[model samples]
Target: MAASAPTLLSTTSRLRVSSAAAFRAATAPLLRGEASEWVVRGEATVQVLGRSVRVRLRKRLRMPATRMEEMRATDVSIERGDNATGVLTVASRVSFFSRSSLELVQMGALRVHAYYDAGANDPAVPAAERRARAGRLSSSSVRVGTVLLPNYELRAGYNELEEQIHFDQSLGV
Candidate 1:
C-alpha cells in the first residue's frame, strides 16, 4: 500500500505538469495574436480624356497585430494604373464594439509611396518636380460599415479626394 501510494502521487504530478503545458499551448495564440496576410487584385474603370480606361488595382495587406476589439495593418500597399503606375502605402487602424459588431470603424493615412513612376521621361518636368509629385500626394480616410468575419465586408470611405463605398460578399459554399 505504501509503494502504491508513492506511484499514484508521481502519476498525478505528471498529469498536472502535462495539463499545464497543454493549457499554455492552447492559450498562446489567443494571447499573442496571429498575423494574417491579405491580397486584393481588381480593375477600376477610369475616364481619361473622355475615354474609359481600365486600370489594374493590386493591394497587398498585412495585419500584423490584432487585439480584442482592434486590428492594425502596418504594411499595406495599393497600386493603381497600368501605364503610369502610382503606388500608395498606408497604415490602418480599425476598431469595433460588440453592440455594433456590424459597424467597423477604420482610420487610415498614407505612409509613403512605394513607387510613382510618372513623367519620368519628360524633360520638361524637372527632376525635383518628378520627385515631389509623389510626396505632394497625401490622403487620409475614415470608413464605417459592416464586416462579417472571414467572408464579407462592406464599408463607405471618405477621403481627401472622394467618398467611395464598396461591398464584398461571398456566395455559395
Candidate 2:
C-alpha cells in the first residue's frame, strides 16, 4: 500500500493591548542595543482557538539586544534580540460583577519566545515567497507619497508586468 501525503495545517491568532505605554518602555532599551529589564502592565484582548478573552496582564522582559538595521528609503530603523525570551501573567474575572463570587482564578502564566535576524532582506530568501507577496498588489491603482514623493507611475508599470508574469506561469504558458 502506498503512503498518503502529509496534510499541512495553519492557524492564526490576534492579540491587542489597549495600554502599551509600559510595553513600549520595556522594549525601548532592547531596540537600542542594550541589556534591559522592565515590566509591562496593560489590558489585552486575545483571540485563540475560536475563543475571545479579555484580561489584565503584567509582563516582565529581560533580554540583550542583538541586531539592528536602518532602512535607506525612509531613514527608519529597527532592532531586535537574539533568541529573546520572557514571561507574563494574566488575570480575568470568571463571573460578572457581583458580591457573591464562588471562586477567583488568578496567576495564569505564559512563556514568550522571540527571535530576530538582521539578514532577512538578504538574497537567501526564496524567490517563490517574494513573488507570492508581490502578487497581492493590483495593477490598476497608484498612490503617491505625501512627503519625499516617489515615482509611482514607474512602480505601477513594474507591478503590472510582475503580475502578468506570475499569471502566465500559473497557466503553464
Candidate 3:
C-alpha cells in the first residue's frame, strides 16, 4: 500500500502537468486569432404581443477565435439570470394595426459547439490568402417563429481605428 501511494502521487502529478499542456495546445490557435465557428442551441421564454411564448433557438455563428473567447469572457460576468446584457439582441417588425413587441422573459440554458480552424494561422500563407481560407469567418443565423430571420452582422474585437476593444451586436429579421 505504501508503494502504491507514491505511485499514485507521481501519476497524479504527471496528469496535472499533461492536462495543463493540453489546454494550452488546444487554445493556442484561438490565442493566435484563428477563425472559429459556434453553433448555439438554447431554450427561452419570450413575450410577444402580450402573450408568453416558448422557443427553441438554434443559432450558428462564426468569427475570429479570439473574439469568441472575449465574448465568452464577457458572458462570465453576466449579472442577470433571465436577461442577458447585450449577449442577445432581438428585433421584430411592427405591423400596421397592432403594435408588435418581443421581449425575452427567461433563458433556460445554452449548449454551444465550438470549432477552431487552425489552418488559418499558417505562417507561410499570406494574410489575404489566410482570410480567403477562412471564408465567411464572421456570420450568424437564427430562426424566429416559423421563419428564418436574416442576420445583421457585427463583430467584437480590438478595433485598430478605435484603439480599444469594440463589441457590436444587433439582430434583425
Candidate 4:
C-alpha cells in the first residue's frame, strides 16, 4: 500500500497574571538588553521561528500613584534546550478591560520535535504520534515586541507555515 502524508494540528492558548510587576521583571532582560535601571510599561511582543505572540508590560517607575506611561511593549526570548527550542508564550491579558489595540493574541504553545526524514523514515506519518506542538498566527494579529517595538509584526497565520515556533522545555507549564 502506498504511504500517506504527515498531519499537523494547531490550538489556542492564553495566560494572565495579576502580578504585572513580576512579569515585567522576568521579561525585562529581552525588552531592554544591557541597560541598568531600565524599566518597561505597556504592550510589546516576541516572535519565535515565525509566529507572533502578543505581550503587554506595564511597570511603575515609582511606588507612588503618579507617573507617565512609564513603559509599554512586549519582550520575548528563547533558549535552546538539549532537545528543543521555540517561542515562549506568556501573557496577562484581561478580557473586556484589556487594551483595545492589543499587540497580539497568542494562539497556542510553540514546541520542538524530531522527525526522521520522510524519505529515510516511515512514509506513513503516524496520526497518533504527535511528538511536539506549536501555536499559529491568525490574520490581522499584531506582532509581539519589547523595548523598541518592531516596525512590522510577524506575518499573519504564520503557524500554518513550515515548522513554526520551536521548544523542548520540560517545565510542564
Candidate 5:
C-alpha cells in the first residue's frame, strides 16, 4: 500500500492578562530576544522566532479622563513546536479606567497536520493516533480580522485579488 500523505493543520490562540503592564512584562524577554520559549501555561508553550514593534499612534485623549492613547503594534512569528510558524499582527492600547484591550489582526501563514476521514474507523490505528488525525488541518487557509475599523479609521484597502484581510474595531475610547 502507498504511504499516506502528511497532514497540515492551523490554529489560533488567545491570551488575557490582568493588565497591560503585566502583558509587557511577560513579553519583555521574548521581545528582547532574551528567550525563545514563551510559557503560556504549565505545559503549553510556543517558540518565539522573531518580533518587531512600532509605534502606530501616540496622542492625548481629553475625554472621560485625560489619558494617552499610545498605540503600539508588533509583528511576531511563533512556532508551536509543531514546525508551523504563525505570524501575527497584534496591537496594544493602554488607556484610563483600566479599560485596556489587545487586538489580534491575524494574517500570514501557518501549517500543521491535515486530517482526513478516508480510513477513520480503521481499528489498526490507536485511539490517540486517530484523535490526532481526526481534526488536524493546516492554518494557512484561514483569514480572521476586523473590517469596519480598518476601513473607516485606517482607510485600509481590501482587494480580493491580493487576498487581503483588512479589518478593525474601535470602542471610540
Candidate 6:
C-alpha cells in the first residue's frame, strides 16, 4: 500500500483572492449622462466571497503631436461565476476616448471608484493636471473592464510617449 502527500490548498485559495483584487482594479466608470468609460488590463478576472467574474478589454488609439489628446475605442466583455452558482455572462459594454491610462496605476486588487472627463466639462481644469491625466484621449489608448458594485478601475493609456512629447515640445516651443 502507498499514501499520497497532503494537498497544498492554500495556493488555490490565494488565486481566488488575487482574482477579486484584479477585477476591482479593472472597472472604473467614467460617466457623461450615458457615455461610460474605465480602464483594464490585457486579461483580468475577479472573485468575491464565492462569486467570480472574467473580464477583457481591447482598444485602438491615435494621438496627434499638436494636440494634448487622442482618440481611442475599446471593447469590453465579462463572465461571472460563483462557488454555489455556475458561470454566466454578467456584463459587457464599450467605452471610447479616455484620458487616463491603466498602465500608470499600480496593480493589486483595490476597492476603488473613480470619475473622469474626456472633455473639458470644467473650464477650471488646470493645464498641468489635464496633461498629466492625458485627458481628451490624447494618448490614443484603450481599456476593457468588468465590475461588481462598490467601484474599481484600471487605466488604459493610449499614447503615453506622444503625450510626453507633446509636453516636452510645449516646454521647448
Candidate that would win on TM-score? 3
lDDT per residue as tens, model 6, 53-163 = 875634322211121133322333334444343222333332333343222233333321122454333457787775565533333333222222212223343332111
Q: Which digits, one per residue and each the tens of the lDDT, describe model 2 over residues 83-143?
A: 2331111121111111211111121221111222223333675766544433122333233
Candidate 3 per-residue lDDT, tens place, 69-156, comes to 2221221222222234323322333111111111111222212223344556768768986666552233332222121123211223
User: In each prediction, how many residue pairs overlap at the backbone (N, C-alpha, C within less than 3 A)?
Assistant: 0, 0, 0, 21, 16, 16
Candidate 6 minimal-lDDT segment of 10 residues: 161-170
Residue 158 accuracy (lDDT) in model 2:
12
lDDT of 1 by residue, 38-156 (tens): 34356679998999999874545342332233222223333322323221223233332222112122322211112223454357879776555532222321222222222212222
Tens digit of lDDT per residue, candidate 5, span 16-61? Answer: 3446565545444432223333333222333445644442322221
Instruction: Judging by lDDT against the true structure, name the best candidate.
Output: 3
Stretches of candidate 5 exceeding 4 Å from the true structure: 1-11, 36-173
lDDT of 4: 0.29
Better candidate by TM-score, 2 or 3: 3
Model 1 RMSD vs true structure:
26.1
Which of 1 and 2 is the better model by TM-score?
A: 1
**Candidates ranked, most accurate by TM-score first:** 3, 1, 2, 5, 6, 4
- The pairs that clash in candidate 2 are none
